[model samples]
Target: MEGFTLILLYLALPSLLFSAVKQILTWRKSLGSKPQFPGPRQFPLLGRVHDLPRYSLWLKFKEWADIYGPIYYTRVIDQTFIIVSDEKIAEELLVKRGHIYSGRPQIRSLIRHKEGPTYSALMDRHDIWKAQRKWAHAAVAEAYKHHFYGHVEREMRRYLGLLLLDPSRFLDYTREYCGRVMSRLAWDDATQGRANGDSADTTLHCMSVSGPITNTITPLWHLPAFANPWYRYEVRREREQRDWWLSNFRLAKDRMRRGELPGDTWAYRYFEQVKKEGNGDLNQTEEQEVFASCMIGFLNLVGVVTISGPLKFFLMAMGLHPEWQKKAQAEIDKVCGGRMPTIQDYAALPTVRACMKETVRWRSGVPLGVPHQAERDDEYRGVKIKKGTVVLACEWALNRVPSRYPDGDHFRPERWLEPGWPTYQEPLTRYPNFREGQAMHSFGWGRRTCLGQNLVDDETFVFAAAVLWAFDLAPKVCPRTGEPIPIDTQATNSHVILEPSPYKLDIKVRNAERGGQVLEGYREVMGELRL
Candidate 1:
């Protein structure tokens, strides 16, 4: 609140009020002519914003879906939004007609550099987005598969080592583990990786919430730097973030030059490919450098936030439903024999894989996934949708649609393992894969789907399997109450990513023999994979 800014706002307030009223009148005039989409009652100016709950927003959307029949309309102020909770409609619009629905809401806070937009997620559908995305995908394609698996396994082993050092820090260790692993995957960083991760988490969290202005409104970003403290803070953070990641970018490039990092490392290989794609002259342009850094930066954000989410949920699932945990461990033991589980055992341990997928399905990372903007006017099921309407694929509601998954409340892995359930598929080895964008709608849809899901799948599965194999999870017992604390599945995270509320896990080695084997196996692998 600045004196000059306030004076200007007040001066324009009367005209702004007039425009708002005019917009409302126009909307009301058209209400009767168009097929009114079923949804909560909209107010005079606030739309449905007044009724929106502060937490568990997906639940509220699901409740509305139940009342309004899958598709519904809601608005915040003058901005209209379509909440699509039905898989078929979501698929039809977000996937089938993706060309019209792949655009993202252009938030004013995120800036564009020479390479492209600050973040790929915020960039609307275009050639630059498509090209950057193509390179992103190619960076993780077949040539990099073996390196990907190795990165996952090596990092998982280190995570388990830290867990052995202190079991009480499961949540902290999981978060750090993801940060370190993604950093390694991003740029082969053995130094200052954690710092890079911290900056990424903070930077993306700001991006997701649009920084301090999110709590206020978008107009705050329009104020002069001296007039807006939030804008000043954002500018400061962006400069720091750019410098931090640019250093990592240079380090990875240096490592490649000095032959310190393996040729197979993601950082090494990706840069080489980019150079090849640019016809052997990288030019080292501002766009090239920033694009390279942000590619890795985005990876850091995605892995540290979203990847940690499912693991937290998996831990919670084990506490709430120990039966599935037992089955998973039993499968791991059978598959690995006496040795500790490895990525190679991934296929053989279908129950272990099922547990991981079930937790993700049971509790999606982003319940109301990244919003997609309607690029043009469209109609669906006889209801007209206006161009520029923000469309959200309600993943939570879609996954819990009674007809699709009847046992939605429980953490049951059998749905993925056995037939007769809608989620089931043949060949247990590959059926639960998260890379199938068409089959798995939790991540995202069509052209805008999350990249590097293979990284998430392989890395997360290895860690989840290792945790299940190495330890037994139960709700921590309260000494004073003399009862095990009840695990609340409804606990949630406030950020864009959805994870279980922090809870202490009662973890223990299944047996002394297996515990020793776990440590010994990790030591051997650590020796081989030490960077």
Candidate 2:
């Protein structure tokens, strides 16, 4: 009887000890004694869903940042959002700990046809994402090293010609210019035919329609087509977009097969590599999807929205502030003499660069930056962030931090030239040589920083310099009142991009002779290249 009792006690002791250790580990994994980060009051279950603004959500988040400090948590329904407005905290989490914070939240709208996965900017950080990014970065770098600037220069010349012919339709010209450049790079179609434009327009329209619907009724995406008409519509649009993309890939492949591959464009290079490597991870269908996804990423996601938004704002700025325009023009004239501004003139046109930087800082198209997801539970300072929590770097708020940017609200290009200007020095460094001022957050932060920054900087500088060198942008005169049209700086349209509301501006050629010289240069370049 004593032996049996001893055996029972020993077995019970082992079970008890195992249970005790499990509990301790669970406690450590839990929130424990961490203090709740300050934020707008949340209600039961629904959280702060009711409190969030529909339009200009970034502005509301900024207001909360003012009250709650830089790092604050907001819960919307079951979704946890950690907004980081402070640059240092952003750098620490997004850069230093990028391995954990680089994950992207599941946006159902972006997952076309509920397919396995597509490699686009919208994809979360994963093995496939890593592969896609590696290939994209390499491809873009190669393109840049080759003749990317030549493509840009040709497009810009075409843009200048269009602007000269119809200055009143400047926005249309800008959109077309961006579209053509991106389409040419992606598909090797410099003409930017109806098909390219239609594909881009369709993708944009689908995003515009589906983005808000998905946010409002996320669960609806999982429902059967019979249950939700909206989901049905979304799925149908996704199929259409996919078909269009696949068709383009097929066309490119056919061209490659015929040995008539258009210039060593992005798609041409991608197809060439596919033939060379024959990567086993991707089948023919998957390869097509990846190619199409990249095209959509560059053309619709990065190119059309970002490029056009800033160009509009720059034009508006020039119209509103002629003195700065004059300053930029003076620098351009001093640097380029009679020729149109080139990439070579970038260093000499510091004031023009300042204006470009200021335009980006003043009103970024992507005010909230892209959302990143937490891969696991983590703590920042004293606050707890759970796995899958959505993190926004809050570019709108960070750019306006008064402590870092003195007179942050005002648009002053000279501030970039002043001493001790705040600079970004965390995960990545931009404009290292520009010691006078801090770099702008327009491109974004950490590993998710814009891949096209180098291209954009060169393109924007050339565009701004050429425009300023040739034209004087001024407010259009009111027909009835014969007075200058009042421009409202605050008026903006918040879509995927933050665009200034339609406003009237007059673009007059500074010198007819200079404008003719620009056209002549365009003709000469085109003639020489036989483009």
Candidate 3:
């Protein structure tokens, strides 16, 4: 018995020793011998986690950029932050050498889970991610060019007709219109069927699955023990809803297989093609990659969450600046010949595009570009970036940099008209938000740029032009004081995207002539759509 015990003890000791040695080796490798970047000194283990500002990390990064220069480094816990506040640095890392830097960071429970990767944005060098992005781009192109506009025109007319009947619920009607546009782009011909008094449960299921439930739930894992568990009925309900949606997606796939439902939407088409190409008998790895592609499209379709927030903000801007609305209306009237502006009329009215661009730059949809990670050791002017370090290019700061835009804090669309603006303000103009004519990093940088950029731009123009041409947006009045309440542009919230806080507005038809023009234009477009 003693001999057996001794042998067991000896084996356990060596095993423990080996684990310690392995851990030390890993720690040393991660904290490599490369010289550290010059920045705030942090505690040995904690790093600069505590030093991040209370309000906006992007603004704080701007302040640091001014002091630390463009290329700077900071650390939080075990994670390293490499901030490229300069456009030149962004181009160098994100655009020039994208192969080394355009990868996403691998988050903990966020990406590795039983339900599959919840946050597609956090995938790092997963070939599945690449396949997914490729499929997504193709799907978005098909959706915009082939599927979306018909339903969009129909929804817009429906909202306008509703407004003509009763303008009191204009805001609700607008929200519904935006929702329908997004829903149709996501679901295909089935969505049109839904508009004809059919149930939208399947359609809604497809959408609500892409909700940021993981983001909302993950923080609970960090809660202190003995505290009331944060996992509530609400969280469970959301999870169930997500599962229900995923199951419906599977059912949708089954329907496609049986030829009961055509593979019409991007999701259906991609899945159908994958099955066809893979001979309907893929290995587990290929199946995972195929699913990942569908997931990417799913997230892309839910982009309405991103757009709705900005739309609300733009609505507030119109309400606050009635004069701006009046000017926009005037431009629309002139450009459309008193008719609602079409895609054909977009280029002739440059100011409208300029205003839209300014609105996006002044208050962007995503303040922080999706976080990219270093695939290998790298340096930007001696700023050491070890492998797997998460790097973020703060577009919000880059957009607001005074050097990039003279009087950067103010909103001025005329700057876009000045030819010299591009020469002096090349960085700002190069970004998608500021230059409506060109794609920019407002969607993202490198391989992961938003696939829905073209779709969103097209829809924004159609909806915005229609809104301006049809109505005169004005501020809501205080019943007691009979005075207009103004909007706060900076009143925005951030999770993964920037969104405006909910606010009220007053909307009224421009005039009977303008209303008739809008109706006629919509009818003509609707007839073209055959809806």
Candidate 4:
């Protein structure tokens, strides 16, 4: 009887294990028998979900891209995602075949308005999106043609004023300066009436924090409330903030209707147009649709919202590497002599431009960037790609690839001066200037690339050059240990944006007399602009 039992147990165990293996193979076969991308093999129901990295997903994507080529699919649970890391593949899918690849996937939040449609980042690709993009294009183009220079001048003056006033408040000064600059561009003034009765600076304060919360914490909002309690609070806070922003939107719309075009706010202009149309050119359906989709605050806020991460990253990079700052400052000083750097100064200040370019390359503010969704079925390198696939481009990985930048990890601006760079040999682009030959996808690739890249380009140069000229930065030393406090160039806070972990530094005035130069210089310029 014991012998019989042992033989029976062995037979049953083998059969059970075989069944499990067969079940997994059957599941894979059921998932569209087309050649599966060479990903970590899946379990019966789990797929390759467990293989995904929890954070720093871009790193994992780069690893996978190397093993599986540019357009490969990985499944999480049952959902499959495609990663497009190669420039040529991204261009083909995100640009050439964009009409099919342009549609963003339908996330739960996009369709949450049970009764009526909702306004969200994940709206469908339709006429509304086209119109919204058109409005944004027109608004930015207008600013470029007539108002961008004025905003740039005002920003330069503000930066100088803040630096001159108290360099101790450098962080605050930088934040406020950037906020006010975008505020003027979007709202025509730095009043920040969005804060209700709060201080004029409140809007800027909100602008500063919003970037981190949205860019880093937003993904966490997807976790189940029970599994991740932090998301529960984030959802509550996000709702409250959304309500607050909506109220401000309504107020701004009202003021624009009253013909109170204060400074150079793009919202005021867009709002004025919506009111003038008065449901005539567009029907009630169109009016509400347009309003819901392309409200001025909704559109213009994206500009201010995206700026903080890139700007902060730029500041921290300059602060950490004083040598790079010194070189850039020297170049600017040589070119401008006593004058401030301007758009024309771009050609003469290659080192300064290289610093900006290297900053973007070294640590892209938005490392993974906003994900792009494929609209239809496609093939990449003869492999089948299904419709409605979500694709991510690893700009961080692209920038740091050993092949592209030989010693990929170091922060060396002189690398750009290497024999082959600035020649457009690589299919990928760099930042500040984006032509076919001089492509920089830091803003992004294809149609939906960042609209505010131009604005950011102007602001980044001015701020970096001006701050370095005014201050000499070094790492703060530990009093007891006699060692420098370690700084994190990569200690990123991931929200909808990425920011370096806040760290300490010792900054001395470059010239004792010029301590107030940033502010004093601004006052003089502001005096002229006020008239």
Candidate 5:
């Protein structure tokens, strides 16, 4: 009996010691210096865990930003959070000190990539992450050099066809429009030029699963297996994700084996560009390499899947603010005449570009920008940011920073035109440009920022110019009252992406000449594709 008791004590000693050491450290931290940033008052041990809500977490983050300054923080147990609602602070930490502030946190509960390569942006700050980002940029540049405008025009033509046939389905068609455009650009319709539903389904699942945890201010994502309720959910999701990747990868690769895919497709670049960068040591297995490549391609789709976010916001903006719509149309008319506008006219269509930028700012797609981790202990404004601390840019709050956009919630495209505003620019042709390193906060910040931003910019700018040029967008009329029903900003999805609930838009072709031009473009492209 004594021997048994001794064995049990010996077995429990390490855990007991760990608990004691942890308690001692917490006590010391409480008694000693802490991150000097102001935030919601926290409770002992649990920190600000009580402040997090289950839904619309970004709204809460924004509220905190208003209440507790732009740069604030919260702690959840041992984990630390630093929320940056100010653009200047984001630039300071995420840009100037990017080398120290670019690490990804340990999200073991959400991503199960222990045996494989994870998504490029989600990867820890490592050689592979750097290599993948480099390849992504190179691949996008290569695609643009070869067939950039081709894909946009093809998808744009089909979008016009669908919209003309059924204007009531504008929002649905918008989602499909962006999805299919990116789908083709990623794999060149290897699934026979059709939109890949698998990518959408898997992406939706992955985002939905991670959204709850990732979108929160006090991320309890570091909890161990026994204490985590999301573990089983993550496991199931992880398996589905892996299965989806393998199957899609096999299909794309099988087509490539048969020379069905064109040389400009991402599949070709995955092998020629992404894989060619390394000595084949980045992945663990053939499966891992397949996942890594598929994730690269999958990421291409995910960004566009949410492209609907900005578009939905644009539609709402158009409905709520018709004066801006008129301005955009006038610009398109001046630049494009009776024909639909293309990327070539971008220099002359500053109003259209400004309208597009406004949608993202008015209601950002990623409100709580994906949290960036610190690779080392860093000090900012005399505050100590411990190593491994998770930092959030919080775009929703950043755009609303009192100093940046005084009337943050309102939609005003003219802000980009006024020299008094921060977004203001000179030379209408050049200032409304989607140049990175500016304070847009749309593409994110630092070394970990998106490398495929130009591709998105091209697709969105052309879509905006063409849509406003081709049709007049307004709000639906109330049948009984004869007043235009106000468009709602409430989002449809549960995830962080603020996609507007399907709303009615009053869309009508402005004139016959533009209508004919749209049909001509659609017929010419669809007939050539044989779809």
Candidate 6:
């Protein structure tokens, strides 16, 4: 018995000693090699997880930026994060070093499901992501060349008419307009029927469910499946979402088989590409996956929700600051001459464009741009950033840099106008002769920049311009008090996409004749398109 006890002790001793040594080394590393960047004090093991705000996380991050400067480090659980609030540093890391920094963090909850691969934007830097991005960019560029803006213009007219009919349902109209336009861009036939009705709702639900869950409790992803029921639920939800997208794909495929393929639609283009090029380097499943992914991705993530927030914000801006609305309307009237605002008038309506720019800058839908993961261990400004560290381009902080945007919290369109105005440019790149600065980070930076930015910009400008041309948007008056209800610019729903909270706004046509003109324009556009 004594010999056996000794043998057991001998075996356990070495293993325990090894673990002790390893832990000591880890502790020393943690203690000796502290992060160079300043941040809130971190508790041992937990880091700043408890310090994080459950609601309005972006605002909290912005607050931290003010305290810790533009670049700071924080850890939640075992994951390290490098938050960048400055544009120059963001550009350096996310753009110039994009090859290494564009990798996406693994949110196991988001990708554990079978359909996870379909989320092209959330995908890690890999061959699959490259292929999906290539195909998506091509599809969007093709749609642009095919006069997709014409589709947007037509939809804006219809949207304006819907608002005129029921001003109270402006939110629904905005969301529905986005869905209808996306459906037209994705599947031309689907836009004419019931397909457009529930898509926006479905998309909103999917995002609302998945986004918060995936972002808030990412550490749970490390637990075994049996240990975490939430993981199982999300996986099931994702499967349903995958099925929805597949169903749409099948609808498009069936249409193709019957020789009813719609011209210039993304689905049609994809079908032809597969038939002609034989899926290129990808297998049939991958090809189908890419097609289905791009279709759903663009329709939901980019096409629908991305623009809805900005549209809502634009309306809120109009209601909150009637002066800016009047300025924009004047510009629209000058360029469009009482006719419906068109893309052709874009170059002439600088003030209208400036207003659009200011809306994006003031309250970006995506305040904290999507997280980018470090591909390899790197350093910035003498601060170490380990491989797999989550990098956040904190747009909420970046856009409100005090020097660039005075009274940054205030909604001011004039800041984007002449003389001392910021040099507003697309793609967020600096250029010579552009004086003040640029406000482009709302979309994102570098290789991970929003592929649909041009579409968003063009559509937003056109929609905003048309609405300003057609209506005098104002705050709703209280029937009891007879006082105008204050528009709370800060009253926004907390989500990955910050949307304007439900607010009452009185939307009226500038003139009764203008309402008739809008309806007539919608009829004429529909007739011309044979919709």
List ranges where model 5 is wrong by over 4 Å. Answer: 1-24, 32-35, 113-116, 146-149, 190-230, 272-285, 288-292, 490-494
Task: Mark the regions of model 2 whose C-alpha exceeds 4 Å error after superposition.
Answer: 1-33, 112-119, 147-149, 193-211, 220-224, 278-301, 423-437, 521-531
- Cα error of candidate 5 at position 409, Å: 2.3
lDDT of each: 0.73, 0.68, 0.58, 0.58, 0.70, 0.71
Number of the candidate with higher lDDT, 4 or 6 = 6
Candidate with the greatest TM-score versus the true structure: 1
TM-score of each: 0.90, 0.84, 0.76, 0.78, 0.85, 0.86
Ranking by TM-score: 1, 6, 5, 2, 4, 3
Q: Which stretches of candidate 6 lie over 4 Å from their true place?
A: 1-25, 113-116, 189-214, 219-229, 278-300, 424-437, 525-531
lDDT of 6: 0.71
Better of 3 and 4 by TM-score: 4
The alpha-carbon RMSD values of the candidates against the true structure, listed in the order shown, are: 3.3, 11.2, 8.9, 8.9, 6.4, 7.6
Which residue segments of model 4 deviate by more than 4 Å? 1-33, 48-51, 106-121, 147-149, 160-169, 193-246, 257-259, 275-294, 415-418, 422-437, 522-531
Q: What is the lDDT for 103 in model 2? A: 77
Give Cα distance to truth, residue 296, candidate 5, Å: 3.3
Give residue 503's lDDT in candidate 3 (0 to 100).
61
The alpha-carbon deviation from the true structure for residue 242 of candidate 4, after best TM-score superposition, in angstroms, is 4.7
lDDT of 6 by residue, 252-351 (tens): 7778778786766787887787778765433357456645655554444457767888889988888888888888888777767869988777667777
Judge candidate 6 at residue 364 and give its lDDT.
86
| lDDT score of residue 343 within candidate 5 | 75
Q: Give one digit per residue, the lDDT tens place, for model 2 in 34-89.
A: 58788888665456766676567788889999999999888765567899899888
